[model samples]
Target: MFNKGNKGLFALVLTLFMLTNFVSNAQEGESIFNSKCATCHAPHKDMTGPKLFEVRQKWEEGGAMEGSLHQWVKNWQVAAATDPYAKEVSDWAPSAMTLFADLTDEQIEAVFDYVDEQPKGGAVADAAGAAGGGVASNIATEENDFGWIWYILGAVFLVIIFSVGGVKRQLQELDEDADKQVKVGSKVWVFKNRKYVGIGVLVLVMAGVVWLFLGLYQIGVVSSYQPSQPIAFPHDIHAGINGIDCKYCHNSADKSKSAGIPTTNVCMNCHKQIQGAGDQVEKIKNIYASAGFSPEGGGKYSGETEPIIWNKVHNLPDHVYFNHSQHVEIGGIDCKQCHGDMTKQNELPRVVPVEELNMVEGNIQLTRPTLTMGWCIECHNVKEVSTGTLEGKGGYYDEIHKRLLENDESLYEEYLEDGKVTVNELGGWECAKCHY
Candidate 1:
């Protein structure tokens, strides 16, 4: 409560302080409302939760218990059991609203004040959504981006050139001081030490040739490339906490070469009821808008729809032959072996680097970068051939192992010395195995 004073200077200062405090609280309340409450409770629209505009008046008019509304924000269960009006509010929805036991009474009042102050829709909501996306994209793009590496390399090269030029100038000065002829240019200096210069040039030319081929090798490799997606999906929360298998969303992995992108109906399987939390609700709204799903009373498909443009994450070249079904089902390779542990991934799908993939506890360690031919070949060379691991199986493994022993005993024993026959020992390293 604010205290009142009668005197001139003291009263004026006290009034100014109270005004400042009120403004600060108002701003805080608005921020809290936008972050926590705005998802379900809007000012004008009755969304997932009821429209909260002047809700306090309605509660008070219906004879709410003193400070029960604030207590409800703190914990709905306790409020519902103790307060009659809060009990009535609990039956408003079948699913329970998320508890906000962390918010204080002052904060709750501020949220209410903030919600009341909002002038119903459009510009404000749009601005808020844009601001959130802009901030999130900037931060995430900054984190995993590699565009800065070239700039850093350029700066390093500039420094080296300056340092070398400085050293050359110093050598020229020393030659002048000693009354000896100074090599005025790079050509003159090279001529003076032609043998050493020739050797150095040869080494540099070989290095450049190697670098050119290495750059050409990486043309089709997409290691950590993450493109922007319309919806920000957190794989960690879904795949990790919820224990949803990769095959659930990517159902075609066991049947087809391509693991299909999930349709909007797949999203509706859960989001028909679970409207999501925070800014995620708006993203879900995009799905709803595209599916032409109206969730006013319950939900219904209007038979009109729009498309959601999803960029491909992992793309293989047309010339390369990679089968998802063969690797996932027949070969018994885990998705984590190639995709990294998606359970820990929070951002949109990215081409997981080989270094990160190797760091996964059970994954096979490899030296080459991800999505490169060398990387694939390296994996095939170390990954155990199913023929060696099969104990009682009477399929391809049994026939292949029998043939290896009967036809080529020496070669079979040589491979057996390592105790693990690799895929390369099978036709994995053959030109047609991947190239075709």
Candidate 2:
């Protein structure tokens, strides 16, 4: 403390500590928000809950009682009873705020800090969209470069062979007894090595045949196939940042064979309040047109409307029979199992590759192409009939288990040999299961 150097080092250490602490708090806040608050609140946007940006400052400016904000988070009713400002907050929304009694004051402050620090409208979306675009571009570039890479390698191999042959010829010419030795013609050399040449040709032919068949098999497999849509839907904004559930839009996934596309009325439910800005204005205008909503003169719906024709993304052939309800409600498969993470998807929905699907956490690793018979077979072979235990949840599988247990104990025991019951054990792989 006495020396200048010592003071400088102390200052530096203090600065570093502050910075580290700030980062740790921010990260912790984000984790907690994602786990608990993200479903309702967004930083700069009003979702189910009001926007949290500057909310702490706002409460202070609004003459809220000291420590009332923290108390409100823990139990709004207690805060509202004691503070007039908290009572006003309670009246702001029809839906009640969920109580977070377990959260400490420090945790609530951290969440507010994180929210207040966030960049306003579209910044997060822009960054996420840029990252997603970069990944897609890189994947496309790699696929395009693949054929040229093999060609370049083949050319390099040819050069090496030619260079080795040149050295051998030079050495032979430098030999004193080279004139006495006879050199064979190319045809003569090939004739002498006909057995090896024949074997090589046979191997090449077999390889070509295999390659051709593989190419033929891949004819209809369209992984990463993104078709242009009428409306450019930003799934990142809705699903990722805003935390809209997949089931909210695709509401029929648990009831019907298809996960039904959301109607224009559903879009209007949110867009009626949020008219939007910038490029989003044009997109929202399309929704308005489809829903017959006019934002002008206090936002009324006109009788005239046009239908929005959405292009189907995941299409299976007619011969293949799949039930969305059975998989979603009964089997309890997560949407991300086949669809990958739609939250990060900025572009229109595409046929996600099996490799990408495997990369997603909790997905069963698959070797076959996406949307193929082999892929389905592989999933059915591994995917358990029930998650963890089959005790409480009652469904077709439970009934099947009961029958097997009562009628055929040996068969049930045989099914349990692997310590879990899979879909394949219950006729998932039977010819009639998938086939019409």
Candidate 3:
């Protein structure tokens, strides 16, 4: 019923509408792909699963039945039974593909459209593997790398001394009356300046003693000592991005002597679905092996387990009776107070340097190296004890608070003159408190 010009206009509007819809679908598909499919499958790279790029076309070219690809996405096992091409894909890898039963046919098609649009060479691969290792394995190497700088300076100093001595010798040889002057051998010169030499020797011996003492003081100082673990756990990703609480993994921090390493069962809670992509594929596979889990047949426990031997990061002397529960639960100290801001930590867990710990916001500034006796003593000297509202709680601090208030009024008044009670005033400085 419409004119030829009107019909042409209608066709133009329809084409524009379809193009806009396609663009919208592709954008939605990108979001879905990142949140769900990114854990296992990549657009162009084969990770735990095969590459998704051009997969729809490949299925079609291989004579796949209509709507079978969408069915394969929804439930691959059902698709493999009905379609010959889908069955071939089932045998593509030892690990089975994760089923997306929640996705609609349109969403499944949109995912394919998104995958096909991705550039084949590397962009897709790069984008897919975005959440890679937060910290490098060799990050600790730079912390103790100042020896080379000292070596370079020493070499420069030797060069300057030699150059000056050579210049002086040249000037002496140029003198016409050089032979007329009395020549003194090195031994004769030393004998003439014996007093100065004795002073210099004393100074050198004193300096050597000081240097030796400083070196011995640093014998137990383990700042920035990060050990290689079975799996490179990314604290930035889990704690920073995901906002997982510290207590969730180190469950015994408030109850035991040590903040225990999390078991594989705890890892399986989330990783059962997140199989991982690119470089993370192998790391996640190690977790799977430890947990006795198989991604095949929509993920299951095969009961064939392997232990992940994780190297301990922190260590203390046998004589030190440090209790994790006493400090964490009673003191109410934040993990960051000692551990630094772990949320932004990119590398493997290491003994955080005192300088780095001091830099963290709200942390008490201390000069002593981390994990040293001096560091603990410094913390106790300044750390305020909470005595409020614990009168009837029968807690250790409550009893101490009662004694301060009731036992000695003059001593309590003197202690309060500094504004608050410190751990040192409440027997924290007692040798037996930390020793026995």
User: What is the overall TM-score of model 3 with all chains considered together?
Assistant: 0.57
Clashes of each: 0, 0, 2
Q: Report the C-alpha displacement of residue 25, candidate 1, in angstroms.
A: 53
Residue pairs clashing in model 2 are: none
| TM-score for each of the candidates | 0.54, 0.57, 0.57
Best by lDDT: 2
Q: Write the per-residue lDDT of candidate 3 for residues 181-265, one digit (tens) a residue.
A: 5646643454456467456544543554354335434433567866556578889888999899998999999999899999998
- Which stretches of candidate 1 lie above 4 Å from their native place? 1-217, 387-394, 405-411
lDDT of 3 at 73: 79
User: CA lDDT of each candidate?
Assistant: 0.68, 0.70, 0.69
Say which prediction, candidate 1 or candidate 3, comes out ahead on TM-score.
3
Better of 1 and 3 by lDDT: 3
Clashing pairs in 1: none
Question: Could you arrange the candidates by TM-score from highest to lowest?
Answer: 2, 3, 1
Question: Which residue pairs collide in model 3, if any?
Answer: 39-276, 135-346
